[model samples]
Target: MADDIHTTREPDGTTHTTTVVDRDPKRGGGAGITLLVVAALAIAAFLGFQFLGNEKAETGAVTEAAQKVGDAAQDVGDAAQEAVK
Candidate 1:
């Protein structure tokens, strides 16, 4: 918010003047940026804890799923062999 002025005198003795003004407002983004960063960090921390907390349970569940799949495959193979006989 500043004003710049210019003045000139013509050969006819009449004075001409011009004023240029800047009216843009200036503000700080630190508060918004700080809030965003804090929110992101909080989300990351929450997800990290959830992942770590369920790690062992997830591994055991995966192992059980694999074994069940293996058993199902073996049963299908046996049925196919019997049909081929």
Candidate 2:
């Protein structure tokens, strides 16, 4: 920068100098924060997809249907035994 500077004292008692530096600490903060937020959102989305994405509902429905069929069969068998008695 034009204002940024470097200086040295010479053996002849002369001083050599350069411009002063201009610094802004907040310059990259916004971009860093944005990146952090994006990363967090990506992680959350991945976790959500991992946990919520599956065929469990279909499997559960099939299992429940099978259980109902088994119960119906047991009821029919019991009725037949009673008739025999």
Candidate 3:
């Protein structure tokens, strides 16, 4: 048995019909493109974050090494002054 079908009339006095099988193909394509763009942006953001994190780590290591070198030089200078006394 067929289900009850509904009908509607347009404002211009024309009969317009709609069915479940009638869908807009462009909508499907648009959704696919939107998903693809979002995925691409996500990947790009991840890579950018990784690059920035690595750069910060490298900078921190360099700064720590420089500070240690400066401390050693000060110690050596103190030792030299004590020897001359």
Which candidate number would show the highest lDDT if scored against the true structure?
1
In model 3, the runs with Cα more than 4 Å from the true position are: 1-27
> RMSD per prediction, one decimal?
9.7, 4.8, 8.0
Model number with the top TM-score:
3
For model 2, what is the alpha-carbon lDDT of residue 59? 79
- lDDT, residue 51, candidate 2: 69
lDDT (10s digit) by residue, model 3, range 1-85: 2344457898999886655454445655888899999999999999999999999999999999999999999999999999999
lDDT of 2 by residue, 36-79 (tens): 99999999999888766656777788999999999999999999
Residues 1-85, candidate 1, lDDT per residue (tens digit)?
7999999999999998999998887677889999999999999999999998799789999999999999999999999999999
Q: All candidates' lDDT scores? A: 0.95, 0.86, 0.87
Model 2: how far is 51 from its true place, Å?
Answer: 1.5
Clashes of 1: 0
When summed lDDT is taken over every stretch of 10 residues in candidate 3, the lowest stretch is 18-27
Q: Each model's TM-score, in the order given?
A: 0.42, 0.45, 0.66
lDDT of 1 at 47: 97
Tell me the TM-score of model 2.
0.45
